[model samples]
Target: MNPSEMSFYQPDHDAFRVSVREFVQREISPFYLEWEEQHLVDRTAFAAAGAAGVLGTRVEEAYGGGGTDDYRFRFIVAEELASAGAASYSAGLAVQEDIVIPYVMELGSEEQKRRWLPGLTSGNQLGAIAMTEPGAGSDLQGTRTTAVRDGDEWLISGQKTFITNGIQSDTIVVLARTNPDAGSRGFSLFVVEAGDSGFSRGRKLDKIGLVAQDTAELFFEKVRVGRDRLLGEEGNGLRYLMERLPLERLSIAVAALCSAEAAYGWARDYVFERQAFSQDVGDFQTVRFTLAEIETELEVTRAYVEAATLKLNRGSLTAVDAAKAKWWASELQQRVINRSLQLFGGYGYMLEYPIARAYRDARIQTIYGGTTEIMKEIIGRDIAARAKRR
Candidate 1:
């Protein structure tokens, strides 16, 4: 809502936002609370997004996708969904559209693309990425899942935890160790279908926030992944994960900011209407100043996020830039949401209010999509490497 023209958004972006807003209002807003109770957004919700042409902005049109690779449309979807207090479903959609779809587009072979792209774009079949294991969260090198090559298939056996869309996903892109002692080079990416033998989903995790998102543990017991199922070259999985991480980090940053801003709006409206002592809470000088500070912070973060978004569109976004945005925005969101919830007083603690839900949902932004500590390490290491080169 800041008036600055960041160049990342234009007339087309505005139109797309309107369309997505209408869709969210009609399809998601009415039933999000029920979905949260179930601990999973109904699969029909994604089908609605697909029907509206909002789920496949980056996919090719030949495969039932939006045909344009513009990321702003995708950004609009994330922004609108979060603004509607549909953060849980938004996180799930982010995994599908931003994380999994992009990997397949970049790393999948022609056959892989043809087999997966249509259902993915259409939302008839969901997609999920399996990365974090019980032993490996931020450290990709610690991956212990092994894939041994057999006659025509690679027998994979390991467990992946905290898998997004775990239960509903039809194809899961898994990273497994192909060579036991190759360090980071030992890893390989495999597209494992849900129907494969020994591929089973564990219990859906009972998360503190984002409850409507299907987060679960996945088990692969000698799962058969054919040679053609390999994504790009073997021993190059870590490199692929590294390359695609910037966008995923950026997605988290965007969600954090928009979610925070929405919470602020809810708090502002409540404080103005609710009576405290003798007058509206907004009449207090301290309350007014707090609103001013949060508004300013949101504007400043928006400028940086817009700059990064444009850079991504240009194919010039760097990992360090993304790390900076991810850590700062997520940390800022926590601050802003905590303050906003305080403004609501007793109402904020009640689960019936949007601010309360936003308070809970905002907690996980810093932990997932790479933790704040991990992001700081990435930025710090990049700076040290640059200094050495200079």
Candidate 2:
């Protein structure tokens, strides 16, 4: 689809999008199945992306990035990656752009930025954020990992699970409970490097989908961290996560929408080519009408996501708005996938088809980024507050 038909992206944005799409087609798409079999993409892919200036487009120019501060560039990255049926690539990059870079840019001291931003921007150092523990998934109050005060250093002991880019990460921004007695104010963020004496990595996890992406368990056993490692302020991890999570959710929404778009396009092409009953499936009224309805809904959904993207660029996006986008786009993506698969009949169920793998991977979009139920709770509270104001 021409991006011009979509109102969210401008002409310049479309130009950038086309370049990124070409990059994915030429460098990544053909080799993805092999990478999936190995359970990891070749590290060379990251370097190639960095060299192309696609990996960290927003980081300042002095630090080896393109220095375009626009978030739209990041959105283009998400959209193109999704179009290629490479959600793992989209997600792994989100860790670098959406999840990790923000902490260093907004909260890190000058010395910290000077030391890490250049390498991070150049894809020399991969990063991950450690938040969800074995005991706590969404409830920050239940976090049990603790960082204790010891003169100028803090000793941290905790375990974090389901961390993206965890296996190969060179730096991790860890969220630990610094004050056990305080409820929301008790947590703090710390930056821990790979070689921290007591820090160790757990097994790279086997997951249901996104197999090429590294998802692993992490353990910090009496890890000693210097004062400079603290990210924002002491007892402020909750606040930092709150500030960053909307972007993370938005990234998930972008990926889900793009994946659905790709699936729709693939299935549409397949129906026209496959003949049955001496006619193309596309010739059948039922198949034609099914695609029509799906296409309309997808276009409408794209408009909503684009509007949200604009709000995000303007720094006007709210948590409730992001919740609405994340939940609705993901739910719509699943619906589109299901309907498209039905049109494909038996071929859709085959492992060889890309749609089958997309269906499997799309399942986690709702579950991981705060489930649909959680999103409703957030939206419900917003509704209640507005009612009271009235």
Assess every candidate by TM-score: 0.97, 0.97
C-alpha lDDT values of all predictions: 0.90, 0.86
**For residues 1-390, what per-residue lDDT tens digits would candidate 2 score against the true structure?**
656566666788888887888889888898888888898877677767787778878788877888876778887887777767787777788888788987887889988888778878878788899988888998877888899999999999989999988998898999999998888999999999999988888999998888888889999999999999998889888998988778888888888888898899989999999999999989999999998999998888888888888888889888998999999999998999989888789989985788888887888899886898998999999999999999
Number of clashing pairs per prediction, in order: 0, 0
TM-score of 2: 0.97
Candidate 2 Cα RMSD after full superposition onto the native fold (Å): 1.3
What does candidate 1's lDDT look like per residue over 1-390, in tens digits? 642244667888888877998999999999999998888899999888899988978898877888886777877887788778998899988998999889888888889998998888888889999999999999888988999999978999999999989989998999999999888899999999989999999999998888889999999999987898999999999999999999999999989988888888888888999988999999899999999999999989988997898899899999999999999999999999999999999989998888888889889889988999999999999889989998
C-alpha lDDT (0 to 100) for residue 111 of candidate 2: 89
